[model samples]
Target: MSERLNGIEAFVAAVEAGNFALAAQRLGLTRSAVGKSVARLEARLGTRLFHRTTRSQSLTEDGQAYYERCRRALAELDAADAALEAGRLTPSGRLRITMPEVLGRVLVAPLLLELGAQYPELSFDAAFNDRRVDLVEEGLDLAIRSGPLDDSTALAARPMGHQWMGMFASPAYLAARGRPASLEALLAQASAHRFVGYVRDSGRPPWQFRDAKGQAVAFTPSSQFDFGCNSLEIAAMAAMQGAGIARLPVWLVREALDQGRLVRVFEEPQAFGYAVHAVWPHARAMPLKTRVLIDLLVERLVPALAVR
Candidate 1:
Protein backbone atom coordinates (compact mmCIF):
# COMPACT_ATOMS: atom_id res chain seq x y z
CA MET A 1 0.00 0.00 0.00
CA SER A 2 2.89 2.40 0.67
CA GLU A 3 4.28 1.56 -2.78
CA ARG A 4 0.78 2.13 -4.16
CA LEU A 5 0.92 5.79 -3.05
CA ASN A 6 4.11 6.22 -5.08
CA GLY A 7 2.42 4.60 -8.05
CA ILE A 8 -0.54 6.97 -7.76
CA GLU A 9 1.77 9.97 -7.73
CA ALA A 10 3.66 8.62 -10.76
CA PHE A 11 0.44 8.03 -12.67
CA VAL A 12 -0.70 11.59 -11.98
CA ALA A 13 2.64 13.03 -13.09
CA ALA A 14 2.52 11.00 -16.31
CA VAL A 15 -0.99 12.16 -17.13
CA GLU A 16 -0.17 15.81 -16.44
CA ALA A 17 3.12 15.76 -18.35
CA GLY A 18 1.32 14.22 -21.39
CA ASN A 19 4.08 11.69 -22.03
CA PHE A 20 5.70 8.88 -20.10
CA ALA A 21 9.27 9.93 -20.89
CA LEU A 22 8.67 13.52 -19.76
CA ALA A 23 6.91 12.37 -16.63
CA ALA A 24 9.83 9.99 -15.89
CA GLN A 25 12.26 12.88 -16.29
CA ARG A 26 10.16 15.16 -14.03
CA LEU A 27 9.88 12.47 -11.35
CA GLY A 28 13.64 11.75 -11.62
CA LEU A 29 13.06 8.10 -12.53
CA THR A 30 13.82 5.95 -15.58
CA ARG A 31 11.14 5.66 -18.28
CA SER A 32 10.76 1.95 -17.61
CA ALA A 33 10.38 2.63 -13.91
CA VAL A 34 7.61 5.19 -14.58
CA GLY A 35 5.84 2.67 -16.82
CA LYS A 36 5.98 0.06 -14.09
CA SER A 37 4.58 2.47 -11.52
CA VAL A 38 1.69 3.38 -13.82
CA ALA A 39 1.08 -0.32 -14.51
CA ARG A 40 0.91 -1.07 -10.82
CA LEU A 41 -1.57 1.76 -10.23
CA GLU A 42 -3.70 0.59 -13.15
CA ALA A 43 -3.65 -2.95 -11.88
CA ARG A 44 -4.75 -1.88 -8.43
CA LEU A 45 -7.55 0.28 -9.82
CA GLY A 46 -8.61 -2.44 -12.31
CA THR A 47 -8.58 0.06 -15.20
CA ARG A 48 -6.27 1.51 -17.82
CA LEU A 49 -5.44 5.15 -17.11
CA PHE A 50 -4.28 6.20 -20.56
CA HIS A 51 -4.76 5.41 -24.23
CA ARG A 52 -1.33 5.51 -25.84
CA THR A 53 -0.27 5.56 -29.46
CA THR A 54 3.08 5.93 -31.18
CA ARG A 55 2.70 9.71 -31.42
CA SER A 56 0.50 10.61 -28.47
CA GLN A 57 -0.92 9.58 -25.10
CA SER A 58 -4.17 10.83 -23.58
CA LEU A 59 -6.12 10.11 -20.42
CA THR A 60 -9.06 7.73 -20.50
CA GLU A 61 -12.41 9.07 -19.27
CA ASP A 62 -11.89 7.44 -15.89
CA GLY A 63 -8.35 8.71 -15.86
CA GLN A 64 -9.55 12.25 -16.48
CA ALA A 65 -12.03 12.04 -13.59
CA TYR A 66 -9.37 10.59 -11.32
CA TYR A 67 -6.93 13.24 -12.43
CA GLU A 68 -9.38 16.01 -11.54
CA ARG A 69 -9.78 14.65 -8.04
CA CYS A 70 -6.05 14.16 -7.61
CA ARG A 71 -5.25 17.62 -8.96
CA ARG A 72 -7.65 19.24 -6.47
CA ALA A 73 -6.17 17.19 -3.67
CA LEU A 74 -2.66 18.26 -4.63
CA ALA A 75 -3.79 21.88 -4.86
CA GLU A 76 -5.30 21.69 -1.39
CA LEU A 77 -2.09 20.23 -0.01
CA ASP A 78 -0.07 23.04 -1.57
CA ALA A 79 -2.57 25.61 -0.29
CA ALA A 80 -2.21 24.23 3.25
CA ASP A 81 1.56 24.47 2.96
CA ALA A 82 1.23 28.05 1.78
CA ALA A 83 -1.24 28.88 4.57
CA LEU A 84 1.20 27.67 7.23
CA GLU A 85 4.04 29.60 5.62
CA ALA A 86 1.87 32.70 5.24
CA GLY A 87 1.36 32.90 9.00
CA ARG A 88 5.11 33.05 9.51
CA LEU A 89 5.90 35.38 6.58
CA THR A 90 4.40 37.47 3.81
CA PRO A 91 2.09 35.78 1.25
CA SER A 92 4.16 33.87 -1.27
CA GLY A 93 2.84 32.20 -4.42
CA ARG A 94 2.33 32.62 -8.18
CA LEU A 95 -0.69 34.78 -8.94
CA ARG A 96 -1.94 34.45 -12.53
CA ILE A 97 -3.79 37.46 -13.94
CA THR A 98 -5.26 38.47 -17.31
CA MET A 99 -6.11 41.86 -18.76
CA PRO A 100 -6.24 43.93 -21.96
CA GLU A 101 -2.89 44.44 -23.64
CA VAL A 102 -2.82 48.21 -23.94
CA LEU A 103 -4.05 48.72 -20.41
CA GLY A 104 -1.68 46.10 -19.09
CA ARG A 105 1.32 47.70 -20.78
CA VAL A 106 0.30 51.24 -19.88
CA LEU A 107 -0.97 50.74 -16.33
CA VAL A 108 -0.73 47.24 -14.81
CA ALA A 109 2.90 46.43 -15.52
CA PRO A 110 4.34 49.26 -13.43
CA LEU A 111 1.93 48.65 -10.57
CA LEU A 112 2.66 44.94 -10.50
CA LEU A 113 6.42 45.58 -10.45
CA GLU A 114 5.96 47.92 -7.50
CA LEU A 115 3.91 45.25 -5.75
CA GLY A 116 6.68 42.72 -6.38
CA ALA A 117 9.15 45.09 -4.72
CA GLN A 118 6.86 45.44 -1.71
CA TYR A 119 6.27 41.67 -1.32
CA PRO A 120 9.41 39.89 -2.43
CA GLU A 121 7.82 36.49 -1.77
CA LEU A 122 5.01 37.10 -4.30
CA SER A 123 5.35 36.54 -8.02
CA PHE A 124 3.05 37.17 -10.99
CA ASP A 125 1.97 35.34 -14.11
CA ALA A 126 0.26 37.98 -16.21
CA ALA A 127 -1.10 37.77 -19.76
CA PHE A 128 -2.76 40.54 -21.70
CA ASN A 129 -5.38 39.81 -24.36
CA ASP A 130 -8.67 41.35 -25.35
CA ARG A 131 -10.52 38.06 -25.61
CA ARG A 132 -12.75 36.99 -22.76
CA VAL A 133 -11.55 33.97 -20.79
CA ASP A 134 -13.28 31.60 -18.38
CA LEU A 135 -11.48 32.45 -15.14
CA VAL A 136 -12.15 29.16 -13.37
CA GLU A 137 -11.44 26.96 -16.39
CA GLU A 138 -8.25 28.87 -17.15
CA GLY A 139 -7.09 28.84 -13.48
CA LEU A 140 -6.84 32.64 -13.38
CA ASP A 141 -6.61 34.55 -10.10
CA LEU A 142 -8.03 37.78 -11.50
CA ALA A 143 -9.11 39.53 -14.73
CA ILE A 144 -9.52 43.21 -15.49
CA ARG A 145 -12.63 43.89 -17.56
CA SER A 146 -13.96 47.10 -19.15
CA GLY A 147 -17.73 47.06 -19.59
CA PRO A 148 -20.77 45.41 -18.09
CA LEU A 149 -19.99 41.93 -16.81
CA ASP A 150 -22.61 39.27 -17.41
CA ASP A 151 -24.29 37.67 -14.43
CA SER A 152 -22.29 34.66 -13.25
CA THR A 153 -22.98 32.70 -10.10
CA ALA A 154 -19.43 31.40 -9.98
CA LEU A 155 -17.58 34.76 -9.94
CA ALA A 156 -17.44 37.92 -7.85
CA ALA A 157 -16.50 41.37 -9.16
CA ARG A 158 -15.31 44.69 -7.72
CA PRO A 159 -16.04 47.88 -9.62
CA MET A 160 -12.90 49.93 -10.20
CA GLY A 161 -14.50 52.95 -11.85
CA HIS A 162 -16.76 54.16 -14.64
CA GLN A 163 -15.36 55.42 -17.96
CA TRP A 164 -17.16 58.01 -20.06
CA MET A 165 -16.99 57.84 -23.84
CA GLY A 166 -16.27 61.04 -25.76
CA MET A 167 -15.21 62.17 -29.21
CA PHE A 168 -11.72 63.50 -29.88
CA ALA A 169 -9.61 64.63 -32.85
CA SER A 170 -6.19 66.14 -33.45
CA PRO A 171 -5.85 69.92 -33.45
CA ALA A 172 -4.66 69.71 -37.03
CA TYR A 173 -7.91 68.09 -38.19
CA LEU A 174 -10.01 70.67 -36.40
CA ALA A 175 -7.92 73.51 -37.81
CA ALA A 176 -8.19 72.19 -41.35
CA ARG A 177 -11.95 71.51 -41.27
CA GLY A 178 -12.91 74.38 -38.92
CA ARG A 179 -14.45 73.03 -35.71
CA PRO A 180 -18.23 72.74 -35.80
CA ALA A 181 -19.94 75.03 -33.35
CA SER A 182 -22.86 72.74 -32.52
CA LEU A 183 -23.99 69.11 -32.88
CA GLU A 184 -26.08 70.01 -35.94
CA ALA A 185 -23.15 71.83 -37.46
CA LEU A 186 -20.91 68.88 -36.73
CA LEU A 187 -23.39 66.56 -38.46
CA ALA A 188 -23.52 68.89 -41.47
CA GLN A 189 -19.71 68.87 -41.76
CA ALA A 190 -19.58 65.06 -41.34
CA SER A 191 -19.29 64.41 -45.08
CA ALA A 192 -15.99 66.32 -45.33
CA HIS A 193 -14.44 64.92 -42.12
CA ARG A 194 -12.84 61.53 -41.79
CA PHE A 195 -14.90 59.70 -39.15
CA VAL A 196 -13.65 56.73 -37.17
CA GLY A 197 -16.36 54.29 -36.18
CA TYR A 198 -16.77 51.03 -34.30
CA VAL A 199 -18.66 48.01 -35.56
CA ARG A 200 -21.34 47.38 -32.97
CA ASP A 201 -22.47 43.89 -32.00
CA SER A 202 -25.95 44.45 -33.46
CA GLY A 203 -24.36 45.04 -36.90
CA ARG A 204 -25.18 48.71 -36.81
CA PRO A 205 -22.55 50.59 -38.83
CA PRO A 206 -21.20 52.72 -35.98
CA TRP A 207 -22.47 54.28 -32.78
CA GLN A 208 -24.40 57.52 -32.72
CA PHE A 209 -24.60 59.70 -29.64
CA ARG A 210 -27.78 60.34 -27.69
CA ASP A 211 -28.17 62.92 -24.99
CA ALA A 212 -29.29 62.22 -21.43
CA LYS A 213 -32.73 63.36 -22.63
CA GLY A 214 -32.60 60.54 -25.21
CA GLN A 215 -32.42 62.78 -28.27
CA ALA A 216 -30.67 61.02 -31.15
CA VAL A 217 -27.82 63.10 -32.60
CA ALA A 218 -26.35 62.14 -35.91
CA PHE A 219 -22.89 63.19 -37.14
CA THR A 220 -22.89 62.75 -40.92
CA PRO A 221 -19.37 61.48 -41.30
CA SER A 222 -17.41 63.06 -44.21
CA SER A 223 -15.62 59.81 -44.97
CA GLN A 224 -16.24 56.59 -43.05
CA PHE A 225 -13.17 54.60 -42.01
CA ASP A 226 -13.11 51.28 -40.18
CA PHE A 227 -9.83 49.83 -38.93
CA GLY A 228 -11.71 46.83 -37.44
CA CYS A 229 -10.15 47.18 -34.01
CA ASN A 230 -11.94 46.71 -30.67
CA SER A 231 -9.25 48.47 -28.66
CA LEU A 232 -9.89 52.09 -27.77
CA GLU A 233 -6.16 52.76 -27.56
CA ILE A 234 -5.70 51.92 -31.23
CA ALA A 235 -8.62 54.07 -32.27
CA ALA A 236 -7.33 56.92 -30.13
CA MET A 237 -3.99 56.64 -31.87
CA ALA A 238 -5.70 57.03 -35.22
CA ALA A 239 -7.47 60.12 -33.90
CA MET A 240 -4.16 61.55 -32.68
CA GLN A 241 -2.70 61.12 -36.14
CA GLY A 242 -5.46 63.35 -37.49
CA ALA A 243 -7.37 60.51 -39.11
CA GLY A 244 -10.75 61.83 -37.94
CA ILE A 245 -13.08 62.21 -34.97
CA ALA A 246 -13.00 59.05 -32.85
CA ARG A 247 -15.37 58.06 -30.12
CA LEU A 248 -13.28 56.66 -27.29
CA PRO A 249 -12.96 56.52 -23.55
CA VAL A 250 -11.94 59.83 -21.99
CA TRP A 251 -9.43 58.09 -19.74
CA LEU A 252 -7.51 56.69 -22.70
CA VAL A 253 -7.01 60.09 -24.36
CA ARG A 254 -6.31 62.20 -21.29
CA GLU A 255 -2.57 62.49 -21.91
CA ALA A 256 -3.10 63.64 -25.49
CA LEU A 257 -5.66 66.19 -24.34
CA ASP A 258 -3.28 67.54 -21.72
CA GLN A 259 -0.51 67.86 -24.32
CA GLY A 260 -2.87 69.72 -26.68
CA ARG A 261 -2.46 67.01 -29.31
CA LEU A 262 -6.15 66.19 -29.17
CA VAL A 263 -9.25 68.17 -28.24
CA ARG A 264 -12.60 66.89 -27.00
CA VAL A 265 -15.67 67.44 -29.13
CA PHE A 266 -19.34 67.40 -28.17
CA GLU A 267 -18.94 68.41 -24.54
CA GLU A 268 -22.69 68.92 -24.05
CA PRO A 269 -23.86 65.35 -24.66
CA GLN A 270 -21.98 62.44 -23.14
CA ALA A 271 -22.03 59.27 -25.21
CA PHE A 272 -21.88 55.85 -23.52
CA GLY A 273 -20.15 55.13 -20.24
CA TYR A 274 -18.80 51.73 -19.23
CA ALA A 275 -17.69 50.38 -15.88
CA VAL A 276 -14.31 48.79 -15.29
CA HIS A 277 -14.13 45.93 -12.82
CA ALA A 278 -11.80 43.36 -11.33
CA VAL A 279 -13.39 39.93 -11.58
CA TRP A 280 -12.41 36.69 -9.84
CA PRO A 281 -13.87 33.31 -9.04
CA HIS A 282 -16.03 33.10 -5.93
CA ALA A 283 -14.16 30.45 -4.03
CA ARG A 284 -15.21 29.28 -0.56
CA ALA A 285 -11.90 30.42 0.90
CA MET A 286 -10.08 32.91 -1.30
CA PRO A 287 -6.31 32.74 -0.99
CA LEU A 288 -4.61 35.48 1.01
CA LYS A 289 -2.33 36.41 -1.89
CA THR A 290 -5.29 36.92 -4.23
CA ARG A 291 -7.08 39.04 -1.61
CA VAL A 292 -4.00 41.17 -1.15
CA LEU A 293 -3.53 41.65 -4.90
CA ILE A 294 -7.15 42.64 -5.38
CA ASP A 295 -6.95 45.16 -2.54
CA LEU A 296 -3.84 46.73 -4.03
CA LEU A 297 -5.51 47.03 -7.43
CA VAL A 298 -8.63 48.67 -5.98
CA GLU A 299 -6.61 51.16 -4.00
CA ARG A 300 -4.21 52.10 -6.80
CA LEU A 301 -6.38 51.93 -9.92
CA VAL A 302 -9.26 54.08 -8.68
CA PRO A 303 -7.12 57.12 -7.98
CA ALA A 304 -5.08 56.70 -11.13
CA LEU A 305 -8.22 56.82 -13.25
CA ALA A 306 -10.05 59.43 -11.23
CA VAL A 307 -12.23 61.69 -13.43
CA ARG A 308 -10.51 64.99 -14.09
Candidate 2:
Protein backbone atom coordinates (compact mmCIF):
# COMPACT_ATOMS: atom_id res chain seq x y z
CA MET A 1 0.00 0.00 0.00
CA SER A 2 2.85 2.40 0.88
CA GLU A 3 4.64 1.53 -2.36
CA ARG A 4 1.45 2.21 -4.34
CA LEU A 5 1.10 5.62 -2.67
CA ASN A 6 4.73 6.48 -3.46
CA GLY A 7 4.25 5.38 -7.09
CA ILE A 8 1.07 7.48 -7.33
CA GLU A 9 2.86 10.52 -5.88
CA ALA A 10 5.69 10.18 -8.40
CA PHE A 11 3.23 9.68 -11.27
CA VAL A 12 1.31 12.80 -10.22
CA ALA A 13 4.48 14.88 -9.90
CA ALA A 14 5.75 13.75 -13.31
CA VAL A 15 2.44 14.53 -15.03
CA GLU A 16 2.15 17.92 -13.36
CA ALA A 17 5.83 18.87 -13.73
CA GLY A 18 5.97 17.73 -17.40
CA ASN A 19 9.31 15.89 -17.09
CA PHE A 20 10.97 13.29 -14.81
CA ALA A 21 13.87 15.71 -14.01
CA LEU A 22 11.42 18.37 -12.82
CA ALA A 23 9.32 15.74 -11.05
CA ALA A 24 12.44 14.49 -9.24
CA GLN A 25 13.09 18.06 -8.01
CA ARG A 26 9.50 18.40 -6.74
CA LEU A 27 9.48 14.95 -5.10
CA GLY A 28 12.98 15.38 -3.57
CA LEU A 29 14.20 12.22 -5.40
CA THR A 30 16.73 11.47 -8.16
CA ARG A 31 15.42 11.54 -11.78
CA SER A 32 16.10 7.78 -12.06
CA ALA A 33 14.08 7.16 -8.87
CA VAL A 34 11.05 8.96 -10.31
CA GLY A 35 11.38 7.07 -13.62
CA LYS A 36 11.69 3.73 -11.78
CA SER A 37 8.64 4.52 -9.63
CA VAL A 38 6.56 5.36 -12.73
CA ALA A 39 7.76 2.20 -14.45
CA ARG A 40 6.79 0.12 -11.42
CA LEU A 41 3.31 1.72 -11.45
CA GLU A 42 2.96 0.93 -15.18
CA ALA A 43 3.95 -2.73 -14.64
CA ARG A 44 1.49 -3.10 -11.76
CA LEU A 45 -1.34 -1.60 -13.84
CA GLY A 46 -0.38 -3.52 -17.02
CA THR A 47 -0.27 -0.28 -19.07
CA ARG A 48 2.42 2.24 -20.02
CA LEU A 49 1.66 5.67 -18.53
CA PHE A 50 3.82 7.84 -20.80
CA HIS A 51 5.33 7.70 -24.34
CA ARG A 52 9.13 7.59 -24.07
CA THR A 53 10.81 10.30 -26.13
CA THR A 54 14.13 12.19 -26.25
CA ARG A 55 12.53 15.56 -27.06
CA SER A 56 9.16 15.38 -25.27
CA GLN A 57 7.02 13.14 -23.00
CA SER A 58 3.26 12.97 -23.48
CA LEU A 59 0.59 10.94 -21.61
CA THR A 60 -0.63 7.78 -23.27
CA GLU A 61 -4.37 6.94 -23.69
CA ASP A 62 -4.49 4.88 -20.46
CA GLY A 63 -2.21 7.39 -18.74
CA GLN A 64 -4.59 10.30 -19.44
CA ALA A 65 -7.54 8.45 -17.83
CA TYR A 66 -5.49 7.37 -14.81
CA TYR A 67 -4.08 10.92 -14.39
CA GLU A 68 -7.58 12.44 -14.18
CA ARG A 69 -8.68 9.85 -11.60
CA CYS A 70 -5.53 10.38 -9.51
CA ARG A 71 -5.91 14.18 -9.64
CA ARG A 72 -9.53 13.99 -8.43
CA ALA A 73 -8.57 11.51 -5.69
CA LEU A 74 -5.76 13.79 -4.42
CA ALA A 75 -8.09 16.82 -4.48
CA GLU A 76 -10.68 14.89 -2.43
CA LEU A 77 -8.00 13.92 0.08
CA ASP A 78 -7.01 17.60 0.44
CA ALA A 79 -10.65 18.58 0.95
CA ALA A 80 -10.98 15.95 3.69
CA ASP A 81 -7.96 17.35 5.50
CA ALA A 82 -9.36 20.89 5.26
CA ALA A 83 -12.73 19.70 6.61
CA LEU A 84 -11.08 18.13 9.69
CA GLU A 85 -9.11 21.33 10.31
CA ALA A 86 -12.22 23.49 10.05
CA GLY A 87 -14.11 21.19 12.41
CA ARG A 88 -11.32 21.22 15.00
CA LEU A 89 -10.77 24.98 14.96
CA THR A 90 -12.53 27.22 12.49
CA PRO A 91 -10.90 30.65 12.67
CA SER A 92 -13.83 32.39 10.96
CA GLY A 93 -16.67 34.78 11.83
CA ARG A 94 -16.48 38.34 13.17
CA LEU A 95 -13.90 38.97 15.92
CA ARG A 96 -14.72 42.37 17.43
CA ILE A 97 -11.94 43.93 19.53
CA THR A 98 -11.68 47.22 21.42
CA MET A 99 -8.29 48.82 22.12
CA PRO A 100 -6.72 52.22 22.68
CA GLU A 101 -6.15 54.21 19.47
CA VAL A 102 -2.43 54.62 20.11
CA LEU A 103 -1.79 50.94 20.95
CA GLY A 104 -3.78 49.86 17.92
CA ARG A 105 -1.73 52.00 15.56
CA VAL A 106 1.64 51.09 17.07
CA LEU A 107 1.47 47.43 18.08
CA VAL A 108 -1.84 45.73 17.34
CA ALA A 109 -2.28 46.92 13.73
CA PRO A 110 0.72 45.05 12.27
CA LEU A 111 -0.06 41.89 14.27
CA LEU A 112 -3.65 42.01 13.02
CA LEU A 113 -2.36 42.04 9.44
CA GLU A 114 -0.29 38.94 10.16
CA LEU A 115 -3.25 37.21 11.82
CA GLY A 116 -5.41 37.89 8.77
CA ALA A 117 -2.83 36.34 6.48
CA GLN A 118 -2.58 33.25 8.71
CA TYR A 119 -6.34 32.67 8.82
CA PRO A 120 -7.93 33.49 5.50
CA GLU A 121 -11.48 32.81 6.70
CA LEU A 122 -11.16 35.13 9.70
CA SER A 123 -12.22 38.80 9.68
CA PHE A 124 -11.77 41.58 12.24
CA ASP A 125 -13.89 44.41 13.64
CA ALA A 126 -11.44 46.72 15.39
CA ALA A 127 -12.59 49.72 17.46
CA PHE A 128 -9.90 52.21 18.51
CA ASN A 129 -11.51 53.17 21.79
CA ASP A 130 -10.18 55.70 24.30
CA ARG A 131 -13.06 55.44 26.72
CA ARG A 132 -14.31 52.32 28.48
CA VAL A 133 -17.29 50.65 26.83
CA ASP A 134 -19.65 47.92 28.06
CA LEU A 135 -18.08 44.87 26.38
CA VAL A 136 -21.07 42.59 26.87
CA GLU A 137 -23.58 45.32 26.05
CA GLU A 138 -21.51 46.45 23.04
CA GLY A 139 -21.11 42.82 21.82
CA LEU A 140 -17.33 42.89 21.76
CA ASP A 141 -15.22 39.73 21.81
CA LEU A 142 -12.07 41.28 23.33
CA ALA A 143 -10.78 44.48 24.94
CA ILE A 144 -7.10 45.50 25.24
CA ARG A 145 -6.78 47.97 28.10
CA SER A 146 -3.87 49.73 29.76
CA GLY A 147 -3.17 49.69 33.53
CA PRO A 148 -4.58 47.19 36.00
CA LEU A 149 -7.67 45.06 35.44
CA ASP A 150 -9.14 46.31 38.73
CA ASP A 151 -12.47 46.80 36.99
CA SER A 152 -12.43 43.16 35.89
CA THR A 153 -15.11 41.05 37.61
CA ALA A 154 -17.06 39.30 34.87
CA LEU A 155 -14.19 39.25 32.38
CA ALA A 156 -11.31 36.83 31.89
CA ALA A 157 -8.17 38.96 31.87
CA ARG A 158 -4.67 38.29 30.57
CA PRO A 159 -1.83 40.81 30.83
CA MET A 160 -0.06 41.33 27.50
CA GLY A 161 3.17 42.86 28.78
CA HIS A 162 4.70 45.36 31.18
CA GLN A 163 4.62 48.84 29.67
CA TRP A 164 7.20 51.24 31.13
CA MET A 165 6.70 55.01 31.39
CA GLY A 166 9.73 57.19 30.61
CA MET A 167 10.40 60.91 30.51
CA PHE A 168 10.67 61.88 26.85
CA ALA A 169 11.53 65.24 25.26
CA SER A 170 12.14 66.35 21.70
CA PRO A 171 15.70 66.54 20.36
CA ALA A 172 15.31 70.27 19.77
CA TYR A 173 14.11 70.80 23.35
CA LEU A 174 16.98 68.71 24.74
CA ALA A 175 19.49 70.49 22.47
CA ALA A 176 18.27 74.00 23.41
CA ARG A 177 17.90 73.23 27.13
CA GLY A 178 20.90 70.84 27.17
CA ARG A 179 20.43 67.15 28.02
CA PRO A 180 20.39 66.42 31.74
CA ALA A 181 23.52 64.47 32.77
CA SER A 182 21.63 62.69 35.54
CA LEU A 183 18.16 62.37 37.12
CA GLU A 184 19.15 64.94 39.77
CA ALA A 185 20.34 67.32 37.06
CA LEU A 186 17.01 66.79 35.23
CA LEU A 187 14.99 67.62 38.39
CA ALA A 188 17.22 70.57 39.26
CA GLN A 189 16.80 72.04 35.77
CA ALA A 190 13.07 72.51 36.48
CA SER A 191 13.13 76.24 35.76
CA ALA A 192 14.57 75.60 32.29
CA HIS A 193 11.87 73.04 31.38
CA ARG A 194 8.13 72.95 30.69
CA PHE A 195 5.83 69.89 30.90
CA VAL A 196 3.16 68.35 28.68
CA GLY A 197 0.90 67.14 31.47
CA TYR A 198 -1.58 64.27 31.22
CA VAL A 199 -4.81 65.44 32.85
CA ARG A 200 -7.69 63.11 33.71
CA ASP A 201 -9.94 65.69 35.46
CA SER A 202 -8.39 64.33 38.68
CA GLY A 203 -5.62 66.93 38.16
CA ARG A 204 -2.40 67.42 36.15
CA PRO A 205 -0.40 64.16 36.07
CA PRO A 206 2.66 63.82 38.32
CA TRP A 207 5.91 63.18 36.45
CA GLN A 208 6.60 59.75 37.96
CA PHE A 209 10.00 58.02 37.88
CA ARG A 210 12.24 55.69 39.90
CA ASP A 211 15.21 57.07 41.83
CA ALA A 212 18.60 55.41 41.39
CA LYS A 213 18.00 53.66 44.72
CA GLY A 214 14.72 52.28 43.23
CA GLN A 215 12.45 54.56 45.27
CA ALA A 216 9.24 55.91 43.68
CA VAL A 217 9.26 59.67 43.11
CA ALA A 218 6.32 61.70 41.87
CA PHE A 219 6.34 65.41 41.06
CA THR A 220 3.54 67.37 39.36
CA PRO A 221 4.68 69.42 36.37
CA SER A 222 4.37 73.02 37.56
CA SER A 223 5.34 74.72 34.30
CA GLN A 224 2.60 73.72 31.89
CA PHE A 225 2.99 75.78 28.71
CA ASP A 226 0.62 73.70 26.56
CA PHE A 227 -2.33 71.26 26.49
CA GLY A 228 -3.02 68.71 29.27
CA CYS A 229 -5.38 65.89 28.37
CA ASN A 230 -5.70 62.13 28.82
CA SER A 231 -4.41 61.32 25.32
CA LEU A 232 -0.83 59.92 25.15
CA GLU A 233 -0.85 60.47 21.37
CA ILE A 234 -1.51 64.17 21.84
CA ALA A 235 0.99 64.53 24.70
CA ALA A 236 3.70 62.71 22.68
CA MET A 237 3.05 65.06 19.77
CA ALA A 238 3.19 68.04 22.14
CA ALA A 239 6.61 66.89 23.41
CA MET A 240 7.82 66.47 19.80
CA GLN A 241 6.90 70.10 19.12
CA GLY A 242 9.30 71.10 21.95
CA ALA A 243 6.40 72.18 24.20
CA GLY A 244 7.88 70.32 27.18
CA ILE A 245 8.85 66.91 28.58
CA ALA A 246 6.18 64.25 29.11
CA ARG A 247 6.03 60.76 30.58
CA LEU A 248 5.24 58.55 27.60
CA PRO A 249 4.95 54.80 27.12
CA VAL A 250 7.99 53.14 25.53
CA TRP A 251 5.85 51.53 22.81
CA LEU A 252 4.26 54.86 21.86
CA VAL A 253 7.59 56.74 21.74
CA ARG A 254 9.68 53.84 20.29
CA GLU A 255 9.57 55.21 16.71
CA ALA A 256 10.50 58.70 17.87
CA LEU A 257 13.28 57.32 20.08
CA ASP A 258 14.66 55.17 17.24
CA GLN A 259 14.67 58.14 14.85
CA GLY A 260 16.16 60.47 17.55
CA ARG A 261 13.05 62.67 17.48
CA LEU A 262 12.62 61.97 21.19
CA VAL A 263 15.22 60.99 23.81
CA ARG A 264 14.87 59.37 27.22
CA VAL A 265 15.63 61.89 30.00
CA PHE A 266 16.95 59.45 32.62
CA GLU A 267 18.87 56.18 32.56
CA GLU A 268 17.27 55.02 35.83
CA PRO A 269 14.52 52.41 35.66
CA GLN A 270 11.10 54.04 35.26
CA ALA A 271 9.00 53.53 38.40
CA PHE A 272 5.58 53.96 36.79
CA GLY A 273 4.70 50.93 34.66
CA TYR A 274 1.39 49.59 33.37
CA ALA A 275 0.20 46.32 31.85
CA VAL A 276 -1.87 45.99 28.70
CA HIS A 277 -4.67 43.57 29.52
CA ALA A 278 -6.73 41.38 27.20
CA VAL A 279 -10.21 40.98 28.61
CA TRP A 280 -13.07 38.78 27.48
CA PRO A 281 -16.53 38.17 28.91
CA HIS A 282 -16.89 35.26 31.31
CA ALA A 283 -19.06 32.69 29.61
CA ARG A 284 -19.77 28.94 29.53
CA ALA A 285 -17.35 28.26 26.72
CA MET A 286 -15.05 30.63 24.86
CA PRO A 287 -15.44 30.46 21.09
CA LEU A 288 -12.68 28.64 19.22
CA LYS A 289 -12.05 31.61 16.97
CA THR A 290 -11.81 33.95 19.95
CA ARG A 291 -9.40 31.60 21.75
CA VAL A 292 -7.19 31.38 18.64
CA LEU A 293 -6.97 35.17 18.33
CA ILE A 294 -6.37 35.75 22.04
CA ASP A 295 -3.60 33.12 22.10
CA LEU A 296 -2.04 34.69 19.01
CA LEU A 297 -2.18 38.23 20.50
CA VAL A 298 -0.68 37.16 23.85
CA GLU A 299 2.10 35.23 22.10
CA ARG A 300 3.01 38.02 19.68
CA LEU A 301 2.44 41.05 21.94
CA VAL A 302 4.67 40.17 24.93
CA PRO A 303 7.96 40.41 22.97
CA ALA A 304 6.78 43.08 20.52
CA LEU A 305 5.74 45.39 23.38
CA ALA A 306 9.15 45.09 25.09
CA VAL A 307 10.93 48.39 25.98
CA ARG A 308 14.13 47.62 24.04
Best by lDDT: 2
lDDT for residue 181 in candidate 2, whole number 0-100: 71
Candidate 2 minimal-lDDT segment of 10 residues: 148-157
Off by over 4 Å in 2: 1-88, 181-184, 200-203, 212-215, 223-230, 269-271
Q: Tell me the tens digit of each residue's lDDT in model 1 across 46-115.
A: 9988998899988999999988987787678668867765685576788899987777767777888988
In model 1, the runs with Cα more than 4 Å from the true position are 1-89, 182-184, 197-205, 208-210, 214-231
Measured by TM-score, the strongest candidate is 1
Evaluate model 2: give its lDDT. Answer: 0.78
Per-candidate Cα lDDT values, in order, are 0.74, 0.78
- Relative to the true structure, candidate 1 has a C-alpha RMSD (angstroms) of 13.7
Note the residue pairs that clash in candidate 2.
none
